[model samples]
Target: MDISQESGLVWTEVDLSGVFDLDVDESLELESVGDGRVLAVSASPDVVNNVLVTDNGVDWAALPIPNGFSPWSVDITGERWLILGRDPTKEAPGTQILFSDDRGSNWTELAVELGPFDGTAWIGNAIVAGRLIVAAVQSDTWQPQLDEALDDDMAYEPSEKHVHLFLSDGGPAELVAEFQGWYTGGHGASDGFHLIISGPAAEDYLLHSPDGRQWSSTIVDVHVTDSARNELWTADPTDGRFKLERFEGVFGSDQVLTLPDGIGWMPDLAVGPAGVAAVGGPASPNDELGGDFTLPDISIEKNGYELRYNQPEGGITLWDLNEDSAVYVFDAETLQSEGEFQGVSEVEDASGSNVVFHDPETGAELVAFSGEELAAAVTEEVSAAYSEYDPDEFIIGWSTDGTDWEWQTPQEAFGLPESTPDDNSFTQVQVAVGHDFVIAMVQTYEFLGSDFGEDAPIGVGDSQSDSTSAYLTTTTSPSPPRWFVARVE
Candidate 1:
């Protein structure tokens, strides 16, 4: 549970859902469509740039253009066709959207545009209503960039907030809505006419229109901005108490539940087919009484698992996802079995949460509800020597001596490897270390010979074959690692 940044990237799933073969380095993108088949997109499943898709977890076809950086966020139209794109990335500039009429056999360029998106941009929760595509975009101004250069003593620049709205009116990329403030977040729509926003701030500036030209607004409140979307639960930051509130026909007239004062609130709250669940810290005598400790809280309403909570007086609290109902719940602080339970899991005493679930077939997913830090990594090494044949294995390991080894994956290790291929030898390799794991990358040597000759000919061999040294193209020196693991449990 005390995973290093290197260990965090090595994610696993039970079923491929469709095409099951491929090296683990093949980065995958997943979209859960409820009863509908989950969508999995992979760029470089064999090599970066190449795109592949699987439906019903079966047949995988390639995309005409190789999938580029962040080419995985897809919006499925009511029709079978889906809207795919080159999601914004710090490494890769610009943003683009592609339309796939056929499952994924072919695609048409919908639109492309320059993006000011960065680590703070919220593009993941994009929603589609009628013919419009709504993306939670960040402020598009030089102020943010300039802010970094300004002296700390200088006053902070005003924050520019807006939602980039694209409509099918003509082509993709067509600017529709340009509201203000950082992308808070919201979800609700009907026809092209829809009501959407996030965070309590988004509620104030309302934009409802069937066409791009029109917009509107409503009241706003305290913003609930949580990076862990799944753990989108809230509690009073001041007293650490909880109260479940249901958004009634009227905003302030919410149905509030004062929890049994003594229990703490978990960072995550999940609601799905199964039921609603929320987690929090330990319980205290005050938890039963409730007050500020109960002010800001999360409420979930699911079919199977319904739960409400208040910070507890003692012990780690828990919850879980119901596979049958598809509701996601954080694993109990202490593992649970079918039956009545009491007390709580030892929060601080616990090393980390280690509860994960997945479809039985693919084994591609290994979701851990609460565990050590889940680190985001950068590609460390890469090679493009054999574009036709991707190396079957790229192992990451650790050693006190730096020479010994323990095989691991880029997702599992701190620094990951990124490669590019030249005519024969790989042109470049880069390694990136994330929060929880360390990583290393190795590329396969070029087998082709220089003079267009076959094999090594005789002794010294040709230039191409000579270039193929049976050793690592690059090795990284160990250094102080970088990891910031948030304690949500």
Candidate 2:
């Protein structure tokens, strides 16, 4: 179903292939940097030139990266942009921090010093707090010793790991404190007031600091998922069912929410001004089969080959991997379940993966693939497998509230030709939300295999690929993905 023509929702497509190389880059990270602007960085480990900034998400320009530095993460607060990377060419080969005052037009690397320890160090987390830049640095030292067990052979083992918390104010970073433990890097979050760094010992072991200098250590049982303002959202799995808990602070007035049945463990949770939302698929008891959702009995026949798509008595549909996965919305203050919507699965690490974005003027907005209607045409006939389905029909779904949703085909939304001139098909999609707009990244794929001919007989199978093996071998080259900006009024 599509929204009314007068709904005042418009989508514009923006080609990013010229500036960003989506073919070589595995994933893209996007963050809203306020003022209707968004910062995107390509997560290619081997490439250094992969940064872009867009003011409207429709026109994009490349942001230059410093030479000899491979950045892994980018953070921005206000006008300050912090880039954390490693410069292996340095003599000590440790973590390097780059600061930009004018939105990345010029950069300056902060002189970070790791005393005495001669080894490699990398930045696990970095944030811009007001005018001070805080970073968590982990260093690993190699210790070599002669082993007597194997004829005095030389053996090397990593020495004790050290975590250093550094604070800088437009100058060289000062080492504030250091700890000795095995730090699990890449686990951290900031709530605009406090910084929380996880790991170095147990998963629950955390280091908290208000100004990046004085820190306190604590161990919490709940897994912290997101933080907004002064509150934090955690997933509590002590009982048999899934529970979502919100804490006023680390230990303050808290509210516990028992999620509905069929939701998977530790579903993605997000907190915003509008409310809290959790999304995940149903829990699969076994490894080889799907979750506890039943699928419809559908079949199609052509050329002596019966294309039957059936689910085991109590399994999900073969076409929709996220049939039962849903988005559950709740009140921001009372933690009451407002409503729920189905067919939205969670994509890990994407900007707006399983979260709901709150716009003060227009309420909440969410963008995701229409799992049920995505490949509906494939169930009609065997020849339909090779035919070009409408790329713009029923591909993406948008929602203002959790209950009411609007659907649009990619062709209609992006103003593409009714028929793709290159025979490219939509494969994956991800979206990021801003205050006034939503940015969508759609990946297209081209079938490379010649097995799906007009006269070929396609057989039914137990798995999704088994029923249609010809769709497995597809390529993204020649036709790259696309980016779209949607404005809702």
Q: Which number leads on lDDT?
A: 2
Instruction: Provide the TM-score for each candidate, comma-separated.
Output: 0.39, 0.50
Per-residue alpha-carbon lDDT of candidate 1 for residues 376-481, written as tens digits (9 for 90 to 100): 1101111121233232223332221111223334333334344433333321112212212221222223434433343421111111112222221222112222
Clashing pairs in 2: 183-200, 392-409, 392-410, 392-411, 393-409
Tell me model 2's lDDT, rounded to 2 decimals: 0.47
lDDT of 2 by residue, 1-489 (tens): 213421224777776677675553255555544334566765454555666777566667767677656676665535567887767677866567789998777999887665656576766666675567877777778655544345556567756677777788888888888877544322123332233344555445556566677877766544343211112323333443222211221111122333223222212222221222222222232212322222334543222222233333422222212433212322222222344323223444533333222222455433333333224533443234324322123334444332233445445566655544454333434454444576766554444455344443221111111212233342323246577777654
Question: What's the number of clashes in each of the models?
Answer: 106, 5
Candidate 2 residue spans exceeding 4 A from truth: 1-13, 19-27, 43-49, 64-69, 86-94, 118-120, 140-159, 180-193, 198-203, 224-428, 444-479
